[model samples]
Target chain A: MGAILEIKHVSKFFGGLAANSDVSFELAEGMIMGLIGPNGAGKTTLFNCITGYYPPSRGEVIFKGRKMNGLEPNKVCKLGMARTWQKVRPLAKMSVLDNVMVGALCRTNSLKVARDIALEQLKVVRLDRKADFLAGGLPIGERKKLEVARVLATRPQLLLLDEVMGGLNPAESEEIIQLILDIKKHGITQMVIEHDMKAIMRISDRIVVLNSGEKLAEGSPEEIVANQAVVEAYLGSEH
Target chain B: MKTILNKLGNNRGFSPVAISLWIAALAGLALFPQFVDNPYALHVMILFFLSTIMGESWNILGGYTGQYSVGHAAYFGVGAYTTMMLMQYRQIPPWLGMWAGVAVVMVVALVIGSICFRLRGPYFVLASIAVAEIMRLCAVNLKDLTNGAEGILATEIPPFKIGATVVTDFLSKVPFYYIGLSFAVLTIVATMLVQHSKLGYYFQAIREDQDAAHALGISLSFHKNVALLLSAGFTSLAGSFYAIYVGFIDPPTVLALDISVQIVLICIIGGIGTIYGPVVGSLVLVPLSEALRSNLIAQGIFKLGLASEESGVGVFLKENLAHAHALIYGILVVVVILFMPDGVLGFARKLFTARNRGNA
Candidate 1:
């Protein structure tokens, strides 16, 4: 399958500090691409650049043959790219269902229709039972699920998930891994930033490792595990 | 009693019962002036309607959208000045001038939104107050147009006419009452439509989290401005109503910081982000202030035999309570903030839910 998203030599600098430097990657259609990196590896920064939260200092983010440079995050989302924050920010006072409805409303103007779509997405994430509860009252595990459900309601062709599994326990993480696999079955392209190596290795069709704001290695899961440079990048960071 | 009230308030969407209650209320308000001929009563009702319009308008942007502008008086003053100036200087009728006021306020809202929306939190609040202060200063100093501190008094309001038939002259308070009622109803209906529409969801999302909303394809600046425009437009209408009905327009009266604070207080004290929040706020505030101002509460205390008229407590109440309206108002606000941080509606909801849990 052809690439659904192409990031060409993207670089984001914040006042001379390079948060992301010369990062390049392509996410193929219907594939789960795991983006693994140590702390401050510019994973979230790259997600920001792709999602148009911040314009890259230099580079092109081509989404389905359209240039996404300088577009606002909302415009980028309209073009079939949606992202979650590393820190899940749910509409605190709104009900869990209403929070998802906000995302679904982007696809349709009718609240009734949006609610239906939102309910369906909540079921997909197994959060349908807590639909009436305010998003603020949910625990971390549920909130992460809610963040995923909300973005999924937007019906994006490409979803960039920033650390959805960060603070989750092993059981919750397993559920999310299964959820990601299920999302793949639906033919949506996903680029996930994860710190949990085992989880990323289990779900990713392809793995890309980053170190010091640059792409360190890119390959299949087996090749990535075998790559000497990738191993060194991980071990060196521990020191 | 609490459970019954909770059930009624919790009934979401348009059930048959809700629709009937709404129609009955609207009808009652429409026919109020015919049954009541007293001018003082009519004047108080008119003030109630004006307060409702201001509160509801402010609620749109501040409550729903989470853009708490303490500088709404800028638009209010602009609206009042626009109508009063056109009427006084060029012989334009106020009915025509009110629309002009709305138009000017829209432009003013856009300009203010562009500047203030860049800042967030308390910074945004301070920026709004600063902008409003500048407008008030302009009104005070720009003697050429605004007529300076002496203020503009509407010596006459041209009789409202439709096709050569006089609808009503400005002679009776009843005409102003009906106009105020209609404007109040218009604002309430407008707020309801927004609450049910896609716009309301976008506003709430932005209020909850701007970045998250944007990632969901919600344009933050665009939607925020849309809210402010709607809010400023209706608030200008209220300003126009106040100027015409009171027959006075001054920087102190229309453009002061107190006017803006009062608008916000109405929303905050009632309950923010709910349709009836402002309505409840106006109902509580307008009457309480009036009663306090007129020493009616003190008189009522004596009449109820709570205290002898000549007793030390009664004399103190009679002497101090009338002059303590502002102090009492301040105390009420502090109490509400401390005990009921979510305001009255939210506090009531919590109580109802707790009671239900106890029953369960």
Candidate 2:
């Protein structure tokens, strides 16, 4: 299908340092694009630029057919793009249902309708049983799930997840992989920033590797694994 | 007791008994002026209603939206001055002038919100205080518009009328009492509507996490401004009511930092982000302060035989107790913060639940 999101040579400079430099990519509709990078690889910075958390110092972010540069994050979200933070930020003082209801409220003005959408998304993440529990009191695994459920309630066409499984156990990571696959079945485009190699390979339709704020390589999973440059930049020369 | 409390707090729907209780309470309040003739008692009741309006208004922004502005007096003072100016200098009656006050307060809120909402945490607090201080200074210096620091004294309120008939002359405290009561109720109902609506959810989301709320399509500036406008509007109403009731306006009385802090204390001492928090807070604070100001507490001590009438302690109590209300308020706030971080209402709820468990 056609591309749903396009990053055209995007670069972000914080004072003298370049957090992201000329990173270019396109996320095709209904596809899972894995963004793998080493530490300080500018993955999260790129996500911030694309999601309008920060305006890129250079280049453009086109969502659907509109230029998204310099737009606020809320405006970007309203235009069918949503993102989750690297550190799970749940509305701690609010209940799980209420937290998700806030996301669903983007689509409707009625609290009841927002609540129903929240409940439906909660069930998808298997968090329906903890609907009344405060978002802040949940364990990390559950907080990750809550992050997913909340963004899902927004009904975004493109979802960007930043290190969602960073601290998750093997079993939890597996569950998230399955969840990502399930989301793909819904035909929503996704860009997953992850450090876990096997999990990324299993879910991504295409893989882009980044090293020190620039794209190292981009290809199918097998092509990326066999590419000497990607292996050297990501796994080191000894690998 | 547990069952009754649960029935009262139930979210399925309003219980019949609860509804009846509310109606009865409202009816009693509406008819209170008929049976009471003591001006002091009426004055105290009006003060209670004034406190309720201020607390409820502050609770919308500071409690629900987590803006925690300590500069609400800017809106309060602006409202008072606007209404007073129009009534004293221009020919407009206060009833019409209060709406003008609300409109003026909205513009002030927008300017303040734009300046302060850019800063978060302690910075936001500081910006709010600075803005309010600036407003207070402006009020003090603007001689032509605000009558300078000399203040304006409204000699008399015009009579209320409907279609050629005078409804009530502003002779006794009765008219002011009803007006205060109605505005207080209006603020309470407005708060309830906000808490149960989608706007409340967005506000709370911004409070909990700004970035996450933004990622969910809730604009921080937009919602914060909305909260401030609503809060400032109600607070302006309280200001207009106070100005008209007391017939006096000055920088210290209406626009001081103390007034702003008092508005916030009403919410913090009751419970923030809950419907009845300000109500409970106002109920506790107004009577306590009134008693202290009137030296009733010292008299109660003497009457209860805790201190002899002619003793040195008695002399001290009678001489200094009335002026020590501020000190007492400070100590009370410290005690509440230390022992009950959730405020009086939350502390009471916790105690009740623990007692119920013990019985079980």
Candidate 3:
């Protein structure tokens, strides 16, 4: 499959610290790429650099053959690339449907059209019953689903989800996993930063592992599981 | 009670009852001056409309967009000074000069938005206050242009004419009353349009979470500035109206920090981020302050036989309350903030919902 997004040696720095260094990956079209790492391994930082939340200190992010190095997050979104926050930031006072509608509004100017699109997205995430409820009142698992629904409404070609299944129970995580599979069925490329090994292995077509702000391994889930360096990185971090 | 009222108000499509009530209210306001010939009453109504215009204008930015600009008086002062100066010095009529005020304030709003929108939270608030303070100081120091501390006294207003037919002479409060009323209506309609448009949704998204809105392709600075331009334009119109109606324009009268706070207070006390919030705020504040200033509340207490005018409490109310309007206003604001943290409308809605739950 042809690549939809190419992260070429991207690095992010914070003063003297290198949060991400020489991190490179290629996400193929119509495939789910799982990004896994130990705690503080710069998974989110890499996502930020790719999505235009932060300008990479080195290298480039090429999405759909366009360099997205210095564009703002909004501009990047308009280019059909969108990312979800690790901590879901719902428009807390707005209705759940309205929060999704905000994302739909990215593509369509009409609120009526946006609302219909938002409703369809909410149905995909199975949050349509709570569509009228205030977003802040939703539980964390539902809020995460709402975040995915929101980004989905933007009708992005490539979706980056930042630990969307984090903190959810197994049942909730299962639902999200199913939702992610369903999204893939819609023919959209996805990059998921997930901590759950079993879930990631089940869903990801391929896996890339990072350690201490650099790529440790990149292969299929079985190959990644058997890689010595990937095993050692997790083991070393736990100790 | 408030829940039912909210249900009526929150109806997505127009209800017959709501539409008729609105029409009746507008008709009553239109015919009010003819029935009440008392100049003092008309003067109070004019002040009411002026406050409504100011409050509604501020609501566009501060309420809908969640950019709580404490520097709105900068636009107000600019509009008043612009119109008054042109009329007094260049013999330019205020009708033409008001548009000049709007144009100037648009530039001012853009400049201020560029600076202030860079900051967030308390820093944004502080930056806004600083910008307004600088404008006020410039108005004070620029003696040549602003006529110094003595202020501009507009002793004459050319009669409003349409195609050589004199519409109204500047001799009575009736003309000023009608002008203020129309401006107030204009602001209300403008606010309603913004609230229902895509602009309002984008603004509220920014207000709820800036980063989330940005991720959804909403340009933060661009949309915020659009809101501020609309806000400042209407605010300047109110300022121009005040200058023309009151026949005076001074730094304190037009550009004071208190004026900025009052504009915010009108929105906050009613409800922020709602179209009718500022209107409700003006209705509550204008007459409350007027009654307090005139000691009408104190006199009404005596007239109702609550106390004799000679009694200690009654005498104290009559003697002190007139001057204590500001203090009372402060206390009222504190009460609203403490008990009704979401402002009156939200608080009332919550109360009604809770009571309904109890009954259920």
Candidate 4:
């Protein structure tokens, strides 16, 4: 079977600096691939390039057997790709349910259908309790969960989760871990970028570690943690 | 009695409190002829309606989306001049000319919006201004067609008479007054529709975060462009009406930078991003300025007196009062941004939501 998303030798440069250089990876059907990198390893930049926030200076991104090069974000979404931001971008004045409804609006024009789907998404994230509250009023944990709910509302076939576990407590992390697992159970392909090793190791079927804009290693969870180079890179950064 | 009150409010097209206030204001406006039958008063009132419509037209784009444009007169001028010349050259009735103006302006707006809607924040605002100025210059220099700076005049006929009432006379202005008022209402209702629709949610999302809106596949360009079209259509209609009511068309009156800025000011003062604010702003600012000018000119017994040789001081005071409205508007904007941030309707909405929560 073909990979849901394939990034082959794609590089993006900002004037003199290469934000992403020869970065390549793929997500298979129903597979949760972990994209792990230190700050500025260009993980988010690579995501942006794939998602058409920035066009790659060279190379191609293939999504679902189509050349996904320089496609606008909305078109990319229409083609069954969705992403959650590292920072929650909920409409501050809108209720949490309404925030999700914006995403649902993409799938259905009917307000009732959108609202129903939004509520169901909120239920998946355990945010049904706060459905009527303003999104901006949510605490950090709830906001993070709300971002997940927002993406879910879009009903994407391939979900890109950016730092969904970045600043959560262990319990919140565990909750998201189960949510990711449940999402995979529903046959959605997932790619999560997280620094939380425990959560990543628990949920990711495969992990790709990036350092200095290059893919350092890609392997099973245990292999990534056991790789000599991965250990060296983490220790070298300490020095 | 409660049912009767609710029915009366529904008929009046607003809540009871708002309906009564509107009725009282209209009564005050009708009684103005007793105090001043002057053309100046009529002139000011006509300007009032134009500003009101421009401000309300702006509500769809600026107020709803929170994307500010300071160059709305581009559409207004397009509407006014396009229909004005159509009527002058072809002997087209101004009634038909108004619709033609609306169509022309909406097409132009769709094109402009398609190009410029991709830009956001201050970039969008700048593009709107530059485009409006370009059109202004084009209208001025398109000499053979536009009569260059010399403007086209509608061959005047008395107002469509109802049993011997020639109400269309610019001097009478009552008919013009009602026309402007209703157009303003139409703009408001159109805004209210956008606000209530799923389209409104898309606008709010795009305003708050563009990437998020796209992630949801709301198609920002398409929705924003529609908003700009709706806004342009009404603004152009007001412009065509201006040509008919003023019975003369000129570049400055239709396309000036001040005219664009005045709409923004009206929206800001009345309340930015609100359906009711523009109309309220117009109602408050427009007549007050007119009344102030006349009052300043007429010295009262033991009240404030103007002491200018050329009546320059009186004009200065009157103009200052207009400027003062802007000052009040600016301060009000700061206050709203700092305190209410949601705007007048936005604030009211919040209160309603909170009160509803308590009731529930």
TM-score of chain B, per candidate?
0.94, 0.95, 0.93, 0.77
Write down the lDDT that model 3 would get. Answer: 0.92
Residues B1-360 of candidate 1 have per-residue lDDT tens digits of 555555655554655566668879989988888899998899889989999999999999999999999999999999999999999999899999999999999999999999899999899999999999999999999999999999999999999999999999989998898899899989988998898789999999999998899999999889999999999999999999999999998999999999999999898888998888888888889998999999999999998999998999998999999999999999998888788788788888899999999999
Q: Which order, best to worst by TM-score? A: 2, 3, 1, 4
For each candidate, what is the lDDT? 0.92, 0.92, 0.92, 0.81
Give candidate 4 regions above 4 Å deviation: A237-239, B1-49, B157-171, B295-360
Clash totals in order: 0, 0, 0, 0
Residue lDDT tens for model 2, B107-180? 98998898899999999999989999999999999988888899999987889999899998889999999999
Per-residue lDDT over A22-72 for candidate 2, one digit per residue giving the tens place of the 0 to 100 score: 999888999999998889989999999999999999999999979999999
lDDT per residue for candidate 4 within B1-360, as digits (tens), equals: 667767976654458777667669778766765677686766777677777788888887887777788888898899998888877888676777789989999889988888888788899999999989988898899998888788887776334655687545544666676677678667776887777678988888877787788777877788888788888898898888887887787778789887788778777767776777887678656775565555443333114543543477655655565446545555655776577655555577779989999999
Candidates 3 and 4, the one with greater DockQ: 3
CAPRI grade of model 1 = high
Candidate 4: pairs in clash: none
In candidate 2, stretches whose alpha carbon ends up further than 4 angstroms from where it belongs are B1-13, B357-360
i-RMS values of the candidates, in order? Answer: 0.5, 0.6, 0.7, 1.0
Ranking by DockQ: 1, 2, 3, 4
Best by DockQ: 1
Instruction: Give the docking tier of candidate 3.
Output: high
* Candidate 4 residue-wise lDDT, A161-224, digit = tens: 9999888888998898999999999999999999888888989999999888889999999999
